[model samples]
Structures are given as structure tokens and as C-alpha cells.
Target: MKRIVITGTSRGIGFEMVQLFAQQDCEILALSRNPKPVQELNLSNVTALPFDLASTKDLENVESFLKENWSSVDILINNAGKLVNKPFTEITAEELFSVYQTNAVGTFQLTQKVVPMMKSDGHVVSISTMGGVQGSLKFPGLSAYSSSKAAIITLTELLAEEYKESGPSFNVLALGAVKTEMLAEAFPGYEPPTTAREMASYIANFAQTGAQFYNGKLLQVSNSTP
Candidate 1:
């Protein structure tokens, strides 16, 4: 059975991902600051933990769990994100730092912990936003969120080059408007064509086999226009 680790599991896409992965014959670690929702699911193959991507202690706990439970991880899905939908001028320095801390720095740090436990066949998938893509139609109040997410795009490419010889391919997905909590936060009352579960389902499938055919690439998973 494949062993996987997924972050931001309290709700939306991450929550759906945990459920879908649970249906498969694999071991999963589902993490979020509020782990109660996933814990309530009581899936036998899933383990829920209270995790804060910005917290060093929490990051270490994730590493500890992997070390104690599995020899190696097959997939690491960096799905946790933070949104700061405010005018660039109104976004305080601390607010910008927090956004980056959760979306960018945390992802980079977490990968440092998981990559060591992965083989060449392993896959590391990170979720980004179309807003993070340069020239993808910018929004009014997503400066912090989008820019921080953009960092992952470059990081993925650099990692793929660094580890190309050792294995464990790295790729990122730049998603468009999906009916997710984050999307609602960014564009309130706006409806999206895709649902959270639909995106999560696609991500799950990609995490399993995309590495075989791709590395250091960003796939734009959006059917809707900005």
C-alpha cells in the first residue's frame, strides 16, 4: 500500500482528498490546525493530526509520524494555503509574513522533511493558484496570497533539477476558480465551475502517476476563465 501525507485537511479539497484516498488501500496522514473534522470521520486507513504549517513543532511532529510509521512515503501533497484578500496597501507586514509563512515557507520546510523519506519513484505535488502565475489576470486583493504561492512554482522547478538524479519528481498545479473556501474568501459570492471534491479527485490521481511522465512542470487545472 502507498503511504501518503496530505496537509490542509480540515475542509474543502483537502478534506475530500482524505476521504477519497481512504477508499483506496493506502495509509494516509491527514493534517490541519483543526483536526477534529477528519478525526470524526474515523477512517481506518487515515490518521488525523492537528497541524499548523507555520509551526515548527507541528512540522516536526509530521516528520516524526512518518519516521515511526513508515519507512518511506510515496506521495506528499502540499495542499495547505493561506489567503490574504486585502488591498496591497492595507496588508500589514505581519499579515504578509503570515501569508508567506503558511503558503510558501511552510511548504518549503515541510518538503525538507518528507523528501528524505521518499524514493525516486515518489511524487511531491503542490497546489498553487492561477493568480500565482505571471500574466494570468491578476486580482485586486490577492497580492500576498498569490505572490507567496508563486514561490512554490519556482521552488518545484528548482527541486526537480536538484533531485533529478536521485529521483522523487516534483511538480506543481496552478488551479483556477474552484468552489473552495479559499475561493470564496477571495471572491465572495462568486460561483465556480469546479467543486472541491472534483479538484481533489483529480489531484489524487495525479499524485499517483503524474511523476512517471512529468517533473518540474506546472499544470494549469482550470476549465474556467478568469
Candidate 2:
């Protein structure tokens, strides 16, 4: 069975991913700020871990858990993210830092810790936003969120090159607006064309197979034009 590690498994796309991967018979290491949602799923193959990606203590907990339970990971999904929707003029440094802490720094630190435990041919997939793409349609009030996701995109590319000969592959999935709590908060009442479950299905399949054929690419997953 494949050993998969995923962050932000508390709700939204992360929660849906847990459901999809569980059905596929993969052993799941699910991390989230609150473990309740993942635990409630009650899949025997799933291990629910509570860790706030922005907190160093929590990140350390994740590292310790991996050390105790698993020797290597086949797939690592960095899906935890924070979105701060504020006008660029009013955005505070703290707000931008918070988003970066979860979306970029946390991912970098966790990936570094997990790489040593990744099997040869292991895959690292990070969920980025279409807003992060340089030429994609830009939206107001997402300055901090988009920039942080952009950092993940760049980081993934650099890591892919750094690890090219080591066997593990790194890729970014630049997702379009998906109907989730985060989107609702970012753009209230606006319905997105894609749903969390749909994105989860696509991401789960890619996590399992895409690395074999693609690396260091920011593949966009969306049906809507933008």
C-alpha cells in the first residue's frame, strides 16, 4: 500500500482528499489544525494528526509523528494554506506574514523534513492558486494570498531541480477558484465553477501517478477560463 502524507485535512479540499485516498486503499497520514474531522472519517487506514502549520511546535510534532510511525513516504501533499483578503494598501505585515507562514514557510520546512523519509520516486505535490500564476487573471483583495502561493510555486520548481537526480519529484497544482469556505470568505456569495470534491479527485489521482511523467510543472486544474 502507498504511504501518503497530507496536510490541512480538517476540511474543504483537504477533507475531500482524505476521503478519496482512503477509498483507494492508501495508508494516509492526515494533518490538520483540528484532528476531529479526520478522526470522524474513521477510516482504519487513516491516521489523524493535529498540527498548526504556522506554529513551530506543531510542525515539530508532525516531524516526530512521522519518525515514530513511518520510515518512508510515497506521496507528500502540501495543501494547508491561509488566505487573507484585504486591499494591498491596508494589508498589514502581520497578515502577510501569517499567510506566508502557512502557505510557504511551513511547506518548505515540512518538505525538507519529509524528503529524507521519502522513498526513491516519491512525489511532492503542493496546491497553489491560479491567482499565483504570473499571467493569470488577477483579482483585487488577494495580494497577500496570491503572493504567498507564488512563493510555493517557485519553491517547488527550485526543489525539483535540486532533487532531480535524487529520484523524488516536485510539482505544483495551480488550482482555480473552488467552492470552499476559503473562497466564500475571500469573495462572499460568489459561486465558483469547481467544487472541492472535484478538485480532490483530480489531485488524488495526480499525487499517485503524475509524478511518474511530470515534474516541476505548475499544472492548472480548472474548467473556468481565467
- Candidate with top TM-score is 1
Clashes of 2: 0
lDDT of 2 at 46: 98
Q: Candidate 2: lDDT over CA atoms?
A: 0.91
lDDT value, residue 150 of candidate 1: 98
Tens-digit lDDT track of model 2 for 106-211: 8999898889999769999999998999899899999999999999999989999988988699999999889899988888988889899999998999999999
> Per-model C-alpha lDDT, please?
0.94, 0.91
**lDDT measured at residue 6 in model 2 versus the true structure, 0 to 100:** 94
Provide TM-scores for the models: 0.99, 0.97
Runs in model 2 lying further than 4 Å from the true structure: none
Best candidate, lDDT: 1
